[model samples]
Target chain A: MKLAYYPGCVSRSTGKEMDVSTRIVCAALGIALQELEDWNCCGATHVPSELVSVGLAARNLAQTDLPIMTSCSICYSNLRSAALTMEDPQVRAKVNAVLTKKYSGAQIRHALDVILEVLEKNDELITVPLKDLKVAPYYGCLLTRPRGGIDQPEFPTILEKLIKTLAAEPLDFRLKTFCCGGPIFMPQEQAAEDIAFLILKEAKKAGAEVIVTVCPLCHLMLDAKQKALEQRYGEKIGIPVLYVTQLVGIALGLNPDELGLEMNAVSPMPVVEKVYEKMAEEA
Target chain B: MAADEEFKQEVLRLAGPEVLTCIQCGTCSASCPTAHLMKPSIRRLVKHCLEGKKEEALRNETIWLCTSCQLCTVRCPRGIRPKAVVTALKELAEREKIKGKDQAYEELFQRQIKDYGRIAEILLSGEFMFVFPQGALQSMELGLEMAPKGKIKLAVEKIRGRDEVRRIMEELGKG
Candidate 1:
């Protein structure tokens, strides 16, 4: 499987580990990730004008003939929604007006789409079983939203299915599809942190050993700002947040360093060590 | 708040006529995470817009509080996109120059995105501090924590095709 990889802004900046692990895992799955040349921002929810956001996303879509894959849920949703928005002739014409090269509607898929396709075909790819690991599959807003989602929008079990593929237990997390409050982090600090706190507290209560986040911003909120969330909420909720690829990398027997597990703020190292211990004992 | 009176029609045009499809089920506000924190919840926002209550709708600060989760969009049995409706409200608010706490920050954010095509966390924070000093300071500690870990980028790389990016911004943002 080959794809045009558009590692969104956060992937390069705050979520570097996601980019790394995604590349590594794609390589392992014999999937080639062709990085989109001169890709700009996905025109995150912050973009001022709807037309500008569509045009910005249209630029990247027009750049690749091949199906584009992004690890960040924000990028995935923006790209997918842009492609959908272009279905309207008026909107398409308005969007195409700004494009140096007109957008012809490219196929946009999340990295999980390709990875899941490969994993579904060949279960042998998962070398380490991650047996008994209780993973709360965090979809965090975008991976499947706005329309034409990979799974059901309100209730998605695909992440849980992926967890089961890794021989791990998928916890019944009620807040799995809830917002990580990443977008409002700066403007609505207390609200964003309060929402993040809810997710962390729930994960801890549900006995989630680790949370596999679908979006980079989700990782930043749940993992990077975990200390701050703890400080603000006045509680010790320390469930490690890992990129979906990072968790998949773990089950593939990849090294913790290769997965950038240490870079995770909440310290996923203990979870890594536990996985390794289980693997060693199984051996 | 501007009492444009055309606010209802404008929102309908921007967000689609699905605004009229709302059954007032309250599912949207119920599903919304930050709805409780906002002055006018999602359901009420829809009601206010339909009722042509401009100030109660657009100036509510609820539109800005939206995380764009789309839970309201997906969960709406009437297929009304509360997220898109609220986003359209936000866009309309900015276009109308109706300012608020979050709206002011959004303008700064849009300016930064226009500048670099991508955000450099530290640099953006520097400009952001002036508008939102408290919010900036709150994230500063997180920045300090992540900087040593090589997570936060000190400088954001401008894309090679930034000229095209600028043209897109100039054209579409002119609206």
Candidate 2:
């Protein structure tokens, strides 16, 4: 299967691991990701709030002929929201008019939807089972909110299914869709820190050694901000925040470094080392 | 009496008539994650907005602390969208130029949209470091340590859409 991949901005930079691991895992699954040529930013949370129609149109133009695949949660939401909005005739007319003026005809699909479709089609690719891995799947806000398609706005089942496919138990946590305070980081740093702290705290309480996420923004806010959150909250959140793709790569027996696992603020080595020990014991 | 009336009118304008519908059920405040940090309850803030007590609602930092996840909106039995109410209050505050510490973050976001046309990592990290002084050193250390290890890219290629993004921002009147 072929997918037009959109790594978004964060994945191109700080969240490169998400891009790396996603490519590795997809390759293992025999999925070809043809990156969309000269793709632009998705306008994220800001554009949608300000100019909904234009934002949707701009995103639609970036998509190629094939279905779109993204690693960023915010990017996923923005793309999904745009696609959902364009489905409405009135919205489609208005957005299409704008898009036609800017660029030529275009269409888009949410990365999560694409990922799920790929997994469904090639369920057998998850050959190496991820045994005894307790993953607390964190959805954050974008993937699940503001009324969209694919998953329920508040509660999503996609990540849970993906985790289960890899043979891991998905732990239930109250703050699954809770904001990692990604948007608030600049305007309300302390508030953002507190929010992240609370989410990590909840994940820890829920018995998750690793928090798997689909969004690069959530990954950045949770993984990158751990030290600051711990310093402010006076508690260490030892759980490693990982991109779901990275876990899939690990399960597929890909090299850890190739997945860019070391770039994470919270080192995933402890978890990986433990998993390896268990695998060795079983062997 | 006139001042009290004006206050009530302002709150009513901001929160809408539904603010009066609040039964002080404490549902919003109870469910709020940052409730412990708030001095007055979010319920009270909504009540104040409903009563045109705009000053009290805008003065409280709790309004900014809201994650806007709409959890309270779901929890409200009377269909009071406290998050929206808080947002309305925030808009009022912004129009009034009631600057909060985090206002710079808004500027930073604007800068991203206006100048780069995209959210660049180096720029965001620079902004983050500027806002949090400790981040500056940490980021520097990270740059020095991670660059050689290939964990950090010294110069990442900026998308050509930077100018296009700028034009888009200008068209939106945000640039």
Model 1 C-alpha lDDT per residue in residues A1-283, reported as the tens digit of each score: 7799998887766888999899999998999989998888878888746778888899999997999998889999998888888999998998888887889879988887778889989899898888999999888888889768678777888888888989999999999989999998888888898899899999999999999888988988898888887887799987888888998999998988888877888888888889889989988
Model 1 spans > 4 angstroms off: B1-4
Q: Interface root mean square deviation of every model, in Å?
A: 1.5, 4.1
TM-score of chain B of each: 0.90, 0.68
* Model 2 TM: 0.78
**Candidate 1 chain B superposition, TM-score:** 0.90
Best by TM-score: 1
The most accurate candidate by lDDT is 1
Global lDDT scores for all candidate models: 0.85, 0.68
Q: What is the lDDT of residue B42 in candidate 2?
A: 88
Compared with the true structure, what per-residue lDDT tens digits does model 2 show for residues A111-165? Answer: 5556667777777766456778889989877676555455775677888888887
